[model samples]
Target: MIPSLSEATIRHHTIAQSFERGQGYYRAGSVHSLIQRGDRLLARVEGSEATDYQINVYFDQGGITRATCTCPYDYEGWCKHIVAVLLTCLNQPDRIEHRPALATLLASLNREQLETIVQNIANEQPEWMDAVEVQIALLTQSKTQKSQKAPRRTTVDPKPIERQVKRIINRYVEQWNDEPALDEIREIIQKADKFLEQGDGNNALIILGAIVRAYVQDWMNLDGSSGESGAFFEELDDALTEAILSAELTTSEFQQWQKELKNWQKEVVDYGVDSFEMSLTALQQGWEYPPLQEVLQGNITELGAWEDEAPDFADDLAWIRLKILERQGRHQEYLYLAEAEGQTDRYLQMLTKLGRSQEAIALAEQEMSTAGEAWTLAKTLRQQGELKSALNIAMQGLSLGGSNHYGLAVWASELAEGIDLEIAFQTRLKAFQLQPSLPDYLKLKELAGHRWDSLQPELLDTLRQSSSSLHAKAKAAIFLEEGLIEDAIATVTQLSSYESDIIHPVMDAAIAHRPDWVIENARPRAESIINAAQAQYYHHALNWLRRVRAAYLQLGQQEEWHRHRTALMQTHTRKHKLVAMLQQRDLT
Candidate 1:
């Protein structure tokens, strides 16, 4: 909020207030002048070398003001330019005292001044002049003698940090996009390629690093020319990282890969891990692409001799060995590693999954009281038919995390199967209020799935009065139960643009009813719509063409099936061409 100020003090107090409020917006040039109009302050600050900022500060009579800047930050609210203006008003430009004490001022003079004053005085008296001259000569001789004896200072050249960085990247580029530097990167790439060939991510890090280094290097320069490259790199990097980080690679070779990964220069990204981890995540899904997968899995098993490796490789290799054991269902050996690493959560989850719920819950609850852990415990207890314990776990989770209402509702619904509909509905409603997704809605419907439990009139009214779209979905669900397919379809279709998923269930139900009269009437109408408005319904028409192909095959209509298949093939070709163009753009 801006405060109102008069024309006279517009530049002074108003700008001061802006700075005091921490508005540090600045432009290329300093503030030139300021003026005031009707309830507004106009400030002219020099912008870039070629432009200037003409700002307008609108103020209200009650001492409220808002400034609009011409700079880009103005669009974002509060910028450095505003701060500059405020600084100008504070009147502390040089931040030095205007005056000084006599002794302090005299002390500031250099040795040259002291020498000059003494020499001038000495020249007025013959005896003093001679003495001063002798002293001056001695001083000059001493300076010269000292200067001649001192060793010459040599200047070391500034470290070429930027140039070194560039060279490193250029070499990396040559290695990945052109050649390989150390045998390690090449070996890794080869291993990754082989892994990709086999569709195994046993050596994900190596392949991920190669690709990440390639792309991250390309865009780090930040010149606008690399914008598209940067975007593509970011997307690929994110997907690849996700896949690698999520997949637990548990082999001696994979352990070596981890050891090699630690050698990479550590960098921090958006997530909780370092740059290597970030890169690993960013490129995880990239392995799904066949070409990339090939590049990723080129040299997996060829990595040799871990026993005589660097010290950093030991822990990583050991972890991989443990992961392998876990994958083989060798829980005892895996537990050895977990104990060594102090991984309580891993121990708990494994125990819970292995039907040791009581021990797992006790252990997890001792160290942590998290909703996710509690929820998992509840699920395990429920599965083991410990209703009382499961309910207690659910309550604990709800108390800890306000958002666990859905988990509570789930437990309630399960417990109330044949007992009380009202309790189930109430619990579900609480969850729905907190976070309403499809599953929650489905749970509510399921509570009413078996018997027509008359919802209290108020609850029914409340459902009807809720969101129009949700209400439509509820109505459609009711109609679906009554076997009124058309009505269900109609209710869902009312919000067709928004409720695409709702339509799927309704369509599934409607399509199940193939009464002769209804099918005959609807089939021709759909055909007429497709034929008369083909361009308008191109996507839908394509779907209809597919259905026709299937239906004709069922009816032994070979000619019709052939025609539909040909159309679909043509559409497929066109789609492929567009995809090819997009891929080409990525390479460039």
Candidate 2:
């Protein structure tokens, strides 16, 4: 007997929400025709859309071994359809036991019988006929010895692919629907992958190269701040890397690829494309084209002569040369090039790798006249276990104070361990004073530990006097955690401004213990959120309203809740989008 699908298995395949949704789907009789075939359980599940999705689950006594679905839900291993099918199987395992194995029935049929069955299936579903047509043609042709026309050789054009990518980017920019854009990009990448699987590396390269060129061009035109575009470029780089890894190329083929790459580079330069230098660098490094590396090395050697005409190209070649050297374990050569290139990061990395910490420290000290260098040197020293030196360097860096002052404070706190507790506490407090971030405050509290009680009054006084609301929120949170509920409430209520980060926590803490306080306090903030929210951010306001409603429901203040909601609807009558959202959530 096969074991039932466990809750653990459902959670393993998908998230909790999907599993819960699957449960609802199962309960609604959406899963049907569940059949057991060998170790697999198969079913059809009706989805939100009109078409039903096919679900396949491979299982045994241990539980589900594997599952798959035809639904386009790719984030998780198995989709909700699969989960629903599994639930159906677990609930009524006997229903599937009577179903005949499809493969066994197929094996029992004769060749002529199989042909008749195929013909019937083809008649019912014409789309199925395409797969069998080629085999049918081959069989008939052998019997008749008939002549066949030569198939047309279609040329692969990169333009269509490039145009489609550009169109998707433009659509995303106009509407900001990321899911469809990402799906289209992935589909395009799958096309390239199919070409690669068919051993057409050149065409695959062409498709990916076109995408890179288009992305770079678009990045040049855009504001250069859209992280989505950057993510897409990274995905292209990954695809290119995979394509390179999977490619099987001869010496001449590799040389041809190298030529094509150089041509692509030239095209990019001629077009003055910018902001995909890293992508290009990744492609070059991934290619590992031996002849190109050799040529680049030679170019690096003669860079002094070509510096006037092709200085940028010479620099690119030099960087590639350094990468190749590093790959070959030619560290000394890489170090020389790095030093010549004034790449401090690379220089320090090589020094550390070569176990030349003393030289690294000396170089860091020489550079530490600047704040950035001082922080870097201090971090390097700390990592190298020279704690005393690290502390002194951090102090020196703080004294210089040319920005990244928060970094110096963090370093000082980290290095102040086992030295002076008071100094460490002061350093942490200074870090909080500089940034007023929650993490720094948490760190300061942790450092204070048992002494936090003794330090509370002074800390509260300092926070109350501070101009930053972030500090005041931190003080309120500290008070809340310490069980000084009145103090927390008072501190939070005194704030003239309201931020969600400050409001939500305070509301959550007060909701059960002081429902009236939460009701009185959160109403204004929720209204402010609703008033300030744009069409795109109406969902946030709805969420805040939901929380507010939950608090009212808990307090048995349905009348007050209804009145407040009525007022909100009347006040925001012009915001049809927000009103529609509220109606959808049944909040009205």
Candidate 3:
């Protein structure tokens, strides 16, 4: 069911909070629209570029609330776009609306309801009965198309087995949507079975192991049918068990398989510490499968003991496990581990996962004390929609880091955002004084980009007092802020011509101007950046295009703008997607 305007806004706010916490601010910008689809919202934002972002907000079977983003900063499920979208909704609540009551309930169905729903779906959409056939047809078409292509043998240099295994892992990861190489796996298993039939169990064990490795690396291992309990792995896992049982293993072969099994067992245990269960009956029937049962028992017994000890180790373990569980899409397990640890930082981090930042920060401040920690804690506060507290903590953190330190310098840059522009300007002045390096000078200028108008009187006074780099940046900032676009472009173009690394801020400033001067002056540096690229130059070029696009749009030069946009889309669309995501968000 569709989320109410209020619910959607709240969800978006949650995402924005995440964006701020993770430093997801790229080029701050505004949104044009948020199109709704069911519980999902597709938001279009204008920044240095234009792009679509998706947000999903839903309730689980237990009526637990959840939200997620397709944006890159959504590594923790929440991001700045969500927050911006939410804030946008809050300011204009007429954007949100509830789905009709007759529409599908915004909740999961119970077992009986699910059965009824299935019957209803079947009755209305009988094509669901042919789902398997449709899937098979699609697979067959893919294989046929592949077979029609000219085959060329590719050479792969032999590497260490571990390296080969890692390569195999990457191959499967890359082919996440493709079918597993199950035919090859079956071939290996057939060879192993033949060896077993010939009474060569050791050889069979070795071959079977290769088959098992393929399965372990295969993404299909995670798929499960929507049937009985554990229905997902029932077929494939049962086949694996049968293969092990039917094998005629000699003592040596048995020992070798045991060792290999133990390693696989270790990976499983590490990946799923909680909610992994094994039937004691399955273990008792065969010593080979005992490790699964043992691992489960060991974890259960340790849980009680773990609670009585210091929570630090538990927090650390939980942190490590959270990463694993997140990758596995076992989000609930990740949250459970975080809650069990009871560490403020850990809990706050988990709050990001659950989209509960206010609760997270309250807990975080109870224990957070370091400058870095305070900065981080402030981000959580921001995520929870506590803007006042977020700014407060950010100020405190900045003071603790001191003006000369890298942390304060970064904070100064972050504070340049709309809500905290004044604070950003003050902090930037201090930063320039502490470190007069070219980069620092450039950053100070960039921070002053939007603050130029406010700084005009002071900038004139500062120009008279000094002729330092700070004066140049302050002057440039004023020009840009005053909408004297050409003047700002000329200033930075002249400065960047002296040094290439000094090109970034100038490029940014030119883009901010969105003037014809940007296309004229930035062209040379852009070419130089391309010519002198060391792998990292592509990113700079992409940034150049983004800012260039922003400038073009501002100047209303549609034709040249489209040309630049097309070039950007052609050369670095994939590369810039993440950048676009970061920039599109309103981290504040």
Candidate 4:
């Protein structure tokens, strides 16, 4: 069944402009043909295009897990069409026609009927012929074919996949909009992953090798400004590494792969990324590194893969081994490997899973070093139903003061909501002190309730102490939020440079309490723009002028405002555009 959807959920997934725009589309009844098939909502939203766009929203008991639209709206979140469809669902639930899920409908059909349906679909869309062939082959695998060794490898021609990779790279090269291209490339790599998972690592290696070659060839042409390209290359490297580990390679192939991975690792590092370096180690440790075997057999006394020193990718290698063991359902070996290698997260996770909750908790307190580690275990323990323990560890980790304290505090506070008020307040208090943002302070205020008056001064002190430019906006915002108008004025005054966003709010909030300071600050900003003859920026000058006028009027100094306006008009008499703007705004 679909979860309960709300307007807040819809708005959260959409940008403000997109949400408002979607509301317009919904009001115009653009979202039509809405249908709910089990946990999926499918609809066509009429928008500014030749054809209507399709939207699919997938949900479960948790909430809307995914929402997608067949439009080119891939900036950060859901597109307008998706927003409109969800809004329609929330407001007009009766308009949604309910239908059985596709799996349920398919289950009702007999074998012959399913075959006929497949034939019809193939006739209608011949592009699905490949899937049909694969399905047929899978269902008809012979007994001899089924009786294969581990890591059964199958080969594929890399030419087509290589062409697809090159096409994706070329398309994203110009705009540096490599995110969508990365998505497409990752989809291709995921296909190889599926093949590798099914023990057909030969085809997986071919596909992964083709993708890396293409990606490395023209990677420099694409813009990595989004910081996503680095992560994309890492995924490609990881896939190549996994494929190499899984494939049964000839000795020469193994050497070549190791050498090529070293070269790829060198080439891709220009983007400040360390990729394919893992593939090198994977090749070095392929299937039979003696120490790895010893470690797997619960021998921790041996140096084990590194001789008295950890390798560059020791953690990554340990993680990879743990994943392999977990995948093969070798839980005992997984536990031993995790413990032998000091894989605290994996080891504690297994302990919790194995019903050793007290041990996991004790070990978490003693062994976890970073808040990030404790944060992860706290979440794991919470999911494992050790709520009180999770909250306690989170609070303890919060005191450790690592980079993840703010994030862990937030997680712990939410986890403690309706469970323990003091824990919630303490975590949130630490979060606000650590960050000192207005939003955090406000949320802390709500949690502090009657204790806010006592806590308010301490929060305000934190804000006052946040002198970095990074926290300037938040500091000023908290001043305004707390009705500390004079403090808001002082905060804005201290900034050496004017950021209208940080200063303007304080000015607006201080017009009644500190109009003289507003005028003193605003006039200089307005004069700088007007005097510099920046015609394009005259509107900014006008805005500052408007604020100055408001400030003077708030101070009951209208005649003073008139004198300042007339003097400014006379001084910029040659700037006809500026004068005209003043006239247009009735400041003549």
Q: How do the predictions measure up, each by TM-score?
A: 0.32, 0.49, 0.33, 0.67
* Ten contiguous residues minimizing lDDT sum, candidate 3: 274-283
Whole-model Cα lDDT of every candidate shown, in order: 0.46, 0.63, 0.47, 0.77
For model 2, state the Cα shift of residue 399 in Å: 46
Compose the digit string of candidate 2's lDDT tens values, residues 1-588.
244244443544566457778889989989888777776777889887788888877643323546788887867556777778777776766667556668888988999999899889999999988778756765665412321212223447989888988887676665544556666777888988777544455567677877766765664333323335445544665566555434454578567656655555564565443334443444445434443344334433432323234334344445554554554455775776665555565566567557786787677666545566567766666555566666676777776746888767865764574555566677777776776544465566667878877776776666656666656666676666666666667767756543555656776777777877776776666667677866777776776676677778888888887898878778889988877777765564
In TM-score terms, which candidate is top?
Answer: 4
Report the Cα lDDT for residue 127, model 1: 79
Q: Per-residue lDDT tens digits of candidate 3, residues 271-369?
A: 442211121122223433332234223333344224234333334333433443443344554555555444345546556546776665566556555
Residue 18, candidate 3: alpha-carbon lDDT: 58
lDDT of 1: 0.46
* lDDT tens digits by residue: candidate 4, 326-421: 645567778877877778777888888778889988888788877877887777777666778878888888767458887788667656764687
* Model 2: per-residue Cα lDDT at residue 77: 53
User: Model 1, 1-588: lDDT tens per residue?
Assistant: 233121222322233244434333333337756554444555666655468676665544223235567776522334445555544444433331224434565687899997787777877765787676656655665423422211222321223322333454456553233222222233434544444332244244445555545444443432333333233433433434433533445466445545544444343233222345444322232224332233223321212212123233234433443443454455654554444444444556567667787887677667545666566666666556555555566656665653455655555444543345565556666665554433445456555554425643434445445556655765665556556676665565445333544554565565445333223333443455444534544444343333343445445665854664455345445545322332332111
Candidate 3 stretches with Cα past 4 Å from truth are 1-318, 321-344, 347-366, 371-588
Question: Considering only N, C-alpha and C atoms within 3 Å, which residue pairs clash in candidate 2?
Answer: none
Clashes of 2: 0
